[model samples]
Target: MAISEKELLEAGFSNRDVDTLLERLSATGGTMQGFIAALSRRFR
Candidate 1:
């Protein structure tokens, strides 16, 4: 199932933040592990 933009918005992120996160994820070559690690560090 695909996640919709409305779902993201409902999760409390603005469109710009979501877009930026998507851009960063794409720039990382779609590596979910690295993304999760980065997010962990960020939230910590």
Candidate 2:
């Protein structure tokens, strides 16, 4: 399954952040967990 632009927007992400995330996902073959983990680390 793929993430959609609507989902990102609904999740409260700004358009720029959404675009960056989408690019990262494409570069990593849709691996979202790592991105989430990285975000967690940043906030922790």
CA lDDT scores, all candidates in order? 0.73, 0.78
Per-residue lDDT, model 1, residue 10, is 99
Error of 2 at 4 (Å): 7.2
List per-candidate RMSD values in Å.
Answer: 3.7, 3.3
Per-residue lDDT of candidate 1, residues 1-40 (tens digit): 4555677689798999778877887887775456657667
Candidate 2 lDDT, tens digit per residue, 1-44? 45567876898999998889878889878666667667779999
Worst window of 10 by summed lDDT in candidate 1: 30-39
Cα TM-score per model = 0.54, 0.53
**Which numbered prediction scores highest in TM-score against the true structure?**
1
Clashing pairs in 2: none
lDDT minimum window of 10 residues, candidate 2: 30-39
TM-score for candidate 1, residues paired by index: 0.54
